[model samples]
Structures are given as C-alpha cells and as structure tokens.
Target: MDIQKIRRDTIGCEQLIHLNNAGAALMPAVVANGIRDYISAEETGGGYETADKYSAELDQFYTYMAKLLHCRSENIAFTTNATDSFNRALSAVPFKQGDVILTTENDYPSNFIAFISLQKRLGIEIVTVRNTPSGETDLEDLEQKINTLQPRLVSVTHVPTSSGLVQPVAAIGNITKRYDTLYLLDACQSVGQLAVDAIATGADFISGTFRKFLRGPRGAGFLYISDKALQSGLEPLFPDLRGAEWTGIHAYTHREDAKRFEDWETAFALMAGSTAAIKYLLDIGIQEVQTRNETLTAYLRHQLGNVPGVQLQDKGKHPCSIVTFSIANQEPERFKQYFKQHGVNIYTTARSSAIIDFTQKGIEWVARVSPHYYNTEAEIDRFMQLLTAIA
Candidate 1:
C-alpha cells in the first residue's frame, strides 16, 4: 500500500489523529465527492428521473456489497443503518410468545433492547450464552444451550462495540447449523475492518453498516439473507409497497429476494457513497487492510501498556483493531475533552453499552481508541506523548 497516498485520500489525517473508527470513520474523498455529485445530479434533473438515470449506480450497491460479503446480490437489502438492518432482519423471524432467542453477553445494546422489548410484548424467552475464561463466547456452553433450549434464533455479534473482543461466529455457526436453528450475526463492527464470508460464517442473516471502517457516508447499511432464509418464506413484520405487491383487499405477496425488507424511500446519495466506499476497499483488497490494521493496533497496544495509570481492558483470543482502556484518575468525559482539544478523536463506551460484560468486569466506562490502516506509526507516537503528558 502507498501509505502517503492513503493518507492523502483521507482528508482528516492532516488535522486530527482519529482513533474513533468504532464510532465512525473518516470518510474518503472519493465517497464524499460521489455523494455530492449524486445530490447535484438529483437537483439538476427530477427526483424520480434522477433515480432512473442512476439506476445502474444504485444497483452496483448490491454488487459491491455482495463482493464484500461473498454473497449473492439478490440476498442483500439496503437500510438506513446497522440498527435498521438488525431490526428488519430480526422482525422477519417469526417469534412466538414462548419461543426462545439465544444471544451472548457482548451483543450490541440496540439488539439487547430489541430482545427485551420482544420478551415483554411476546413473552419470548431470552437466553444468554456465558463467556469462557478468555472472555469469548463459550462454544461448549453455547452447544449445551442449543441442545437444551432449542432456541428459535441464535444471535451473536461478530465484534463487540465496547472492546476488541471478537466472538467466534464460525464455531457458533457450527452448533446452530447442527440444530437447524436460525442465526443472526451483527457484523456492524467487523464487516469493513476484516474479511467476512457469509457462507463460512453460517449466519442466516448478517447486519452491517458502511459508515464505520468502510469509510462511507452515514445513513446507509445492509442485511444479507441466506438462500435458505429466502426459501423458507420469511417476511418482514411490516411490508411496504417497495417490498410487497398488494394483490387484493387484504392480501399482498412479498418479494422473494432480501429487498422485501427494504422500505419505499431511500437516500440515493448515501447509497452511491456506500457503493464507492465498497469499490475502494475491493480495489485495495480487504486482506491488505486487515494486515495493516493489525500492525497499527499492536503498536498502539504496546505503547498504551507502557503508559503509567493506563489499564488495557480488551479481552479476546484474537482481538481486532479496536483498543479499549481507562486512565487511572480521569473522568471519561474529561479524557475525551482533553483529546479533542489536542486535535485527537476518540470515544468512550459506557457500561450500558454491554451491561453483562461490563458488570462482570466491574467497569463503569472506558475510552476506546481504534486506528485504521491509514494511520501512521508517527501518529501513534504523538498520541502516546500527549497521553503521557496528560497522565
């Protein structure tokens, strides 16, 4: 990779040391310009006419996503964000009053809240799979739970937002596949940071966003539905005209593809930006990005470990680019403010973000520093110097 060119392509590198990729990445110039160009096109022509004119570009959104996910284009559906994708995918699964939904302690907050709502409204049971000693999803415990509970759906987050803890989705998939249970994998944090294969992961539904490590515009995400899920006649709880054809007075036929989960209106500019971001990643190669990111993460981890009063909080067998830690006597808000003042960007993860894990670990909150591949070693050194002075 041309490190200089990569930094040049990212406009923020010159002014800020952005380590908050988990929150939202620095959008590339290509993506931003593409979105602006699309908006200009829409204004020049009519709204509907512009959409028709850009039909090929809009369709490439699916093609690009399919390439990133290693899935068929027909299986992908656009959404406003990862939360939207997850909600839509979850609603498609028929949950009964007494059905069980299995999930992990490290699942995203929005999904956890959705599960609670389902429990209250439908009386569905939410079972949590305990983590192992290393703080990963326990495969043995998960297998036992699958056999005993016969869960209606097995949900797991590919990577938790709070830390570098990456769950073993493939192993979990093995158990879910054996039991013939439906599986939903939240890949919002994992999709762009690492290479993912829908078939190898064995997730019936995978939800993700392009705004994070994908470096695309916000308000754009997607859901990947497996061929089996489509064949099973799974339909969204509320189908709009875009997703279904109204046949009679009270009858409608939902589309067979994953687009059935999509609504009528969409942000075409954002979609165009998302397509450009995917194409950029594909051209550079995900494997290369992953390797570079791992190197940067290792350097940051080593430097942070050496700083006095700093405690590394991330735990996983194979942690990704996300690095979480806490300063000895600094409030999270103050810490964030100090960094912001220094032209550094980082975020904090509250206990409520992952209640079960945070409670078990006795942590109220922690600062998260996530660096992408475009970041330089010199930048990491500068960050360490700033942190040491603060300490």
Candidate 2:
C-alpha cells in the first residue's frame, strides 16, 4: 500500500488526526470531486438532465458494488444507507404470525429495534443467540437454537458499530445454510475494511454503506440479494414503480433482479460519489486495506493498554479498527471536547446504542477511535501522547 499516496489523496487526514473512520472516513479527492462535479452539473443542467447525461456512471455503482461483494450486478440494490438496505430486505421476508427471527445480542442497535417493532406489529418472535465469554457469537449455541426453534430467518451483524468485534459470519452462514433458513447479514462496517464475499457467506441478503469505511459520500448504500432469494420470488412487500411494472389497474410484476427492493427516486449525485469511492477501494484491494487497518488498530490497542486509568472495552479475539476505551471518571463528552480541542477526531458510543453489551460491561459510554488505512503510525502515536496526558 502506498501510505503516502493514500494520505495525500485523503485531504482530511492532513488537517486532523482522523480516528473516526467507522463513523465516516475522509473522502479521497476523487470521491469528493466526483460528488462536487455531479452536484454542479445538476445545478446547471437540471437534475433529470444531468442524470441522463451521467447515466452510465450512475449505473457503474451497481457494477462496482458487485465487484466489492463478489456478486452479479443484478443482485445489487441501491438504498439510502445500511439501515435502509436492511429494512428493505426485512420487508421482503414474508413474515407470518408466530414467525421467529433468530439473531445475536451484539447485533446493530437499529436492527434490533426493527426486530422489536416487527414483533409488536406482526406477533413475530425474536430470539437472541448466546455469546461466548470473549463476546463472539457462540456457533454451537446458535446451531442448537436453530434446531429447536426453527426460525423463519437468521440475522447477523458482520461487525457491530459500537466495537470492532467481528462475528464469525462465515461460520454462522454455514449453520444457516445447514438449517435451510434465510440469512440476512448487516455488513455496514465490514464491507470496505474486510474482504466480504457473498458467495462464501451464503447469506440470502447483505446490507452495506459507502459513507463509513468506503470513504464515499453519505446518503448512499447497496444491498446484495442472493440468486436463491431472487429465484424464490422474494421482494419488498410494497414495491415502488421503479421496482415493478404496472400491468393492469390492480396488478404489478416485480423486477426479476434485486432492484425490486429499490425505490423510485434517488440521489444521483451521491451515486456518482459512491461509484468513485468503491472504484478507489477496488483499485487498492480489500485484503491490503484490511492488513493496513489491522496494523493501525494493533498499535492503537497497544498504546491504549499502557495508559493509566484507561479501560479497554473491546472484546473478541480479532478486533478490527475500532478501538473503544474509557478514561476513569471521565465523561464521554469530555473526551470528545478534549479531542476536538486538540484537533483529533473521535466518537462516542452510548449505552442506548448497545443495550446488552453496555449493560453487561457495566458502562454508560466509551470513546471510539477508528483509524483507517490512510492513517499513519505517527498519527496513532500523537493520539497516544494526547490520551496519555489526559489520563
């Protein structure tokens, strides 16, 4: 990896010690310029006119996303964000009364909320699988629950937003496949930073966002639908005009492809930016990016471990770039203020976000510092110096 070239392309890293890639990485010049130019064209040529002129570039988003996930272009659908993608996929599952959704406690908070809402509205049941002592999804317990419960769908988060713990998604996929149950994967924080192959996971549906690790513009995400789901005729319950054709006064046929989960209108400018960002990552290679991320996080973790009064809150044997820790008797907001004052970027995860995880850990909040491949060891060292003095 060309560390200097990567950091040079990432202009924000030059201005600040960026440690919030999991929230939103600094967009490289190509991506930001792509978005700016598209918006400029939209302002001058009109939205519809600009979309027509750049239609091929907009379509390339799906092609690039297919490359990222190792799926056919027809299997990808565009959405507003990862949660939007997940919700659309969830809507496609033909939930009946008393249907069960088996999931993990460390799942994304917003997704768990959606499950609870589904339970209340449709009388669906939600069951959480047990976690191991180190906080990974217990595969043995998950398989046991699937055998006894016969769940309608099995959902898993590739990586939760609060921490860097990467769940054994591929292994869980094997379990879901063995049970012949539908699998939904939330790959919001894992797609660009990890080599996520849809074929290897065998998930029926996978959701991802470009704004996070992909260094793309906001308001754009993509979903991957397995050919199995397409052949089974699964689609969003309320398909839009873009998703289906109106055959008659009261009839419509959904698209044969994954676009059946998409809406009629979208931000074409954001699509242009996302196209550039995904192409950027594809050019660099995901495995190389993952290696760089592991190196940055390993250094960050080692530095944080040595800070007095600092409690490392990350779990799992293989934590990713997100480093979560708390200073003794220090409010999360204080950490935020301190980092802001020092021109260092960081984020905080609160108790409300990860109910089970935070409640069990006996904490209300933790500081999340996520450094991307563009970040340098020097930046991590500078962050450590600031943190050590604060401690």
Local accuracy of candidate 2 as per-residue lDDT tens digits, 1-391? 8999988998987788888889998999999999999999999999889989998888998899898888899999989999999999999899988999999988999999999999999999999998999999999999999999899999999988888899998899988998868999999999989999998998999999989999998899999999999999999878889999999998999999999999889888888999999999999999999999999899889888888898999999899988898778788888888988999999999999999999889999889999999998998998888888878
Model-by-model lDDT, in order?
0.92, 0.91
RMSD of each predicted structure? 0.8, 1.0
> Per-residue lDDT tens digits of candidate 1, residues 201-274?
99999999988999988899989999999999987899899999999998999999999999989899999999
Q: Best candidate, TM-score-wise? A: 1
Give me candidate 1's TM-score against the actual structure.
0.99
Could you tell me which residue pairs clash in candidate 1?
none
TM-score of each: 0.99, 0.98
- What lDDT is obtained when candidate 1 is compared to the true structure? 0.92
